[model samples]
Target chain A: DAGITQSPRHKVTETGTPVTLRCHQTENHRYMYWYRQDPGHGLRLIHYSYGVKDTDKGEVSDGYSVSRSKTEDFLLTLESATSSQTSVYFCAISESNQGREQYFGPGTRLTVT
Target chain B: AQTVTQSQPEMSVQEAETVTLSCTYDTSESDYYLFWYKQPPSRQMILVIRQEAYKQQNATENRFSVNFQKAAKSFSLKISDSQLGDAAMYFCAYRSARNQGGKLIFGQGTELSVKP
Candidate 1:
């Protein structure tokens, strides 16, 4: 509803394969974030970008990487997917300030066998 | 590090009745922000209400309001005239006020069921 779209909404892949999830926003928000949601763990931030080519790691950044080439596109890549990495990924966008409400994308459900 | 806690894993309320969901947070900073987000079965996160730490008055949005106790570090959401559509998983979140692009820390979430 926030003009945010996540491609490959659902994907099932075998272990040790490379996977990439795409998040595109029409709002051109300055801040973008990638998060994973699991049972019992509501949501864990993986990586975030402040601007084009400016990124930072979050609490759960291990084994995952993110790149922001433009203001509206942020990509999350899994170098070698593992069973443990299977989870629902969400992309969020916000303005350039703190405490602002974040708008979330529908989400991508990735399953690794 | 800031942390949010939602003690109730599940809650229920009758339609047109009132319900309250509890949330507590731990943070060293005196200034921050608290938020409540609702995620329906659709899995889309929606902002239900928000409270600024510096403001003493609780935030009220339509039938939704918050009981923010800054000293106690407790922020609870009260929904009045609950509707069947209110059934969803509610998450409490916290963000730092000092930093730009501050990432949010969320609670485990409380699933609210609206009974008919």
Candidate 2:
């Protein structure tokens, strides 16, 4: 409820297909992050952005890419999606400075067939 | 690399009872923060409590409190008089204070069930 929204709350795509998930925030936070949640493996970071056009790969950045063109919009793309990529994705935003409280939006559940 | 560990996978507590969830972290940085997040069936992540490493006093919010032992690298959440609404997947997270940017290392999570 931190003015964050994830588009395509539920998606189904086939293997080898391209998919892009969008995270939009209204808080104008400077930091945005994308994460994937799987059973037995909490939430694993995929990519994060500190500012417009500034992005960094996370621990599980392989096979995934992200772009932040505006303060509110952060995009995550899975090129040639694989079945292993099927999982629930979450978007988080943090205000500048301490960035202590990272408010999360409702997750997006994606399925790769 | 920093790591958060939640040794308990599942826990159940009767309504109005007290429950404690254990979490331990491994980090070299002396300045950091710990947090407890709750995710219910709705799949929304909710922040329950937070503790700063530099703060010696435990943090409490309503019926939720944290026993943060910085020297022991242990952080535990105690829910008093648990309610059915408290049932959720609880996650322990660690964030380093060295970097101002947002990055959280999360534990696997502990599913807490509040029985009627």
Least accurate 10 contiguous residues by lDDT in model 1 chain B: B95-104
- Across all models, the iRMS values in order are 1.3, 1.7
On a 0 to 1 TM-score scale, where does candidate 1 land against the true structure? Answer: 0.98
Model 2 lDDT, full chain set: 0.93
- Model 1: per-residue Cα lDDT over B1-116, one tens digit each: 88899999999999999999999999999988899999999999999998999999999999999999999999999999999999999999998888646788999999999999
lDDT of each model, Cα atoms only?
Answer: 0.94, 0.93
The reply for model 1, stretches above 4 Å from the true place, is none
Candidate No. with top DockQ: 1
Off by over 4 Å in 2: A97-99
Candidate 1, residue A59: lDDT: 81
